[model samples]
Target: MSLQDWTEAELGIHGRVLPVMQAPDAVLSAASSPVDPADPETVRLAADLVATMRVSPGCVGLAASQVGVARHVFAVDVSGHPKARTVHGTFVLCNAVVEEATRNEKGREGCMSVPDLTGDVKRASRIAVRGRLPGSGEEVVVETDAFEARALQHEVDHCDGYLFLDRVAGAHAVYARQTYL
Candidate 1:
């Protein structure tokens, strides 16, 4: 299927996400991102996100803001974890927020932006998320594991103009693909 003629569509090359957001400034928000489980636009975006996820081997998720749209939206495919792979998920969330960050820990992380280089960053192990599901128009709260939780937190940061690198507390711990960072 030909991709939608989205007015704000953009691409992330390598691991570097386009329009990477910064720290604290866009960390959080109260905006209610809405979705019409029946809306064509929502479905289109979800399909588009899936297609992107499949073709882009490195992209576990992508947020709308990374494409220059401020709307609260993101897609995640959590097959990377062996536990999640048995029956993993490719899902969407709109205007999602972490109601609480449980189990704070510093873990090494990377991004679709700031490709090649990764740093140890602090993240919540569990997040109680509230958002609208694509094509469902239903608002649901998903309490997910650390990996899935981290993925959502990463994308949500983009919507608010924050990037994973900003979450790096101290000097970076271990560096991977330093050429890209």
Candidate 2:
């Protein structure tokens, strides 16, 4: 089955697909706070984040702040991207951080919140991410490369209140991805 199909088959989602907060929304610009990974609320938020991201066409990730919640939590799934070299399936992470990173590489990236633009942002080609798994409170360390690394960095940046535009190489590095296919 495709990633979209997997995303569509909700296992335990209850809350609605939260709105994708756009630019200029203070929530999207402010750093998010950490949450208890074991909290029921966090689990629900994860469900909503994953659902919302899956529903958004071409969205591979979504952060809590983008859903109007200022929490250090996000969901990512890059099972079927052409550029992906490492895949993590679908996962919800809380209190996530990049523990280690290396190999700077510039790549085009877009966000669900910043739908109007795409930018060529410099990011680590390989990254080691640490985070709490929602509902279980278990800590996970993911070492990934290629597009998966880029996706994790993008979502983590959102947790830190930084968007792709903020990391764009230059004005010329930004582009209109309105026709992203």
Best by TM-score: 2
Across 69-88, the per-residue lDDT of candidate 1 in tens digits comes to 45667777776664342213
Q: What TM-score, over all chains together, does every model reach? A: 0.71, 0.91
Regions of model 2 farther than 4 Å from truth: 1-12
Q: Top lDDT: which candidate number?
A: 2
* lDDT for each candidate structure: 0.61, 0.86
Model 1, stretches more than 4 Å misplaced? 1-39, 82-88, 174-181
**Candidate 2 lDDT over residue span 91-165, tens digit each:** 878999999999999989988788788899999999999998877677888889999999999999999998888
- Model 1 Cα shift for residue 157 (angstroms): 1.0
Estimate the overall C-alpha local distance difference test score of candidate 1.
Answer: 0.61
RMSD of each: 7.4, 3.6
Clashes of 2: 0
Question: Candidate 2 at 181: error in angstroms?
Answer: 9.7
Pairs in clash, predicted candidate 2: none
